[model samples]
Target: MIDLARQQLAHDADPLVVKVGTRCLTLPDGTLDECQVESIAEQLVRIGAGTTRRVVLVSSGAVGAGIGLLKLPERPTDLPSLQAAAAVGQCHLMESYNRAFQEHGLLAAQVLLTADDINDRRRYLNFRNAIRALFEYGAIPIVNENDTVRTAELSRTVGDNDQLAAMVTNALRAPLLVILTDVDGLYDGDPADESSQVIGMVEAIDESTTGFAVVGTHKSGPVLSKGGMLSKLQAASIATHAGESVILANGRSPNILVDLMAGEPLGTLIPGQGGRLAERKRWIGSAAMPIGALTLDAGAVEAVAERGKSLLPIGIKAITGIFDKGDLVSLIDEAGVEIARGLTNYDSSDLGKIMGQPSEAIADILGRAPYSVAVHRNDLALVRDAEGS
Candidate 1:
């Protein structure tokens, strides 16, 4: 048996973000399973009842639940159809959550977000404030992508709710992210292949195993099922890198949420980097989507990764794509591996002229210097290995 008390204490001492996937919350027949939803809700309420630690739920199933309610045979293939289903399903989904939480004497608030919402500066802060208010008011905020009005450019974009949950965890400055999926945890290979084994822990998320394929249930497709195990791994990497621990566990078992909060060793635990990033940097690192790429020399890579220095023009080897000043861009090594992401103070056109120049030379070349470094250290997030360390 898992040590429930210890685990719960650990989770309580740390910031915890719980993400419930569609497969776990839905039945085998691709229908919203009320029993499981109620069970999970009860467990969450129990966990949050007396704890000072905040709990935010990033849930999937707006479309799946909608499908069940609309009696659709399969998930829609087109954008409009999917959006329509999501529109109808989001209401039913929230209703189910509200009803379930009420049974536990809790009130649940609905928060719908698009990728663009967090990707923008003003909107991100607004969304964060709204969620914080909900928590302060003693309500559990159930978040999902706003698919109804989201365009392909904005809405159909986030890899999955798993990724969104990670972003939310970072945005909220949570200490831990608990991802409850249908599978037991991450495995070295396919779990049903008879020879695959669950990887008990991950220290770093690297390239060799980063793209593991995610198998899906009848209700979801391999890629569409909340980004599969691979996306969850990526999400874990993001969260853990920002100094937050993550857990990927099976949600099918009875009382699993309660068990996890109780501190039971029921799933794979991804340890976090020891110290937390400052709040502003955390948002820039996790929420800012890179609009372009900046290829760097070996020295620049070392400076940023090891010495924690700002990215200077002297280190830039080449530039790719067009990004405006203040846009988020990726810093890549010579091998085209992304080392980190940061907001640039110069536009692509300006960077092209100032590449490989000293900070002092910026004013000379452009007639006026904006700031010294192209990407400041305070605006960067280093990419972790395939297994989150």
Candidate 2:
């Protein structure tokens, strides 16, 4: 088992985010299984009942839950049709949650979110505050993506609910993230490999760890959700960076949540980086999707990744995509490998003109920039990749 002495593990984890994927939440018929929902609900209520502790459930099954009820032949391919399903199913989803929680003397509060709601600072705070208040009032907030209005662009922009759960975990500065999926945890090799073994713990989840997992597309996904093992690791990176523990376990075993609270390591424990990021910094790092790219020279790569320096205009060699001054952008090497991500001080148009130019030349090119730097060190977050898979 992983050590949790620093996290006050002897007692209940104060704040926990439990995420359940669509596969385990439904049966083969693609309908919302009340037994599964109630079992998970009972587990959550038991955790919430612990003194000074609160629980949040990030459920992803609205569209899939609606399919069987609406008698759809299969998952909808078009955006509008999928949104229609989510609209109908979200009601039933909440009703299931409310009824289940009520049985255990708990209230389930529905909180729907979109990308815009999370990216905007004021809106993000409002969402966070609302959920915090719910916990204080002895209510469990059931969160989900507002799929009713999202199009294809939103899928790439907002990512799936797995990433959304990571955002919520950071927004609340929760110490634990439990992502309940069909499998037990990350495996060393293919699940089919008889010799494969589940990796008991991970210090850092990075690109190499992700290389082994299978990603599920809409058609390839089992029933209703877009998230696969790939999305779970992506979410793990975000939560772990914020200095919170993450567990990827089997949702079919509802007792896993209770077991975790009782100090048992029943899943793959992804340890958090020791440096716990501030709330706003965690938000900036995980909330916004990159709108553009900046290819860094070798010197800049070493400086940012090793020396932790600001991205000066001189180190940038290329710029791709169109992004505004304050938009989040990818910082990559010339070979197109991502090194870091941050909010840019210069717009894409301005960056193009200033690439390979000296810092003093910024004033001559764009008349003047918010600052001489392309990306300030304070606004940056390095991407950690595990050594040798």
lDDT of 2 by residue, 12-84 (tens): 3467888999987887778899999999998887766646778889999899898868988788888888999
For this target, which candidate reaches the highest lDDT against the unseen true structure? 2
Give all candidates' CA lDDT scores: 0.79, 0.81
What would the TM-scores of all predictions be?
0.90, 0.91
TM-score, prediction 1? 0.90
lDDT, residue 237, model 1? 77
- For candidate 1, give the lDDT of residue 136: 81
Residue range 103-192, candidate 1, lDDT tens digits:
877788999988778778898899999988987887889999888877775422666789899889888888778899888787776767
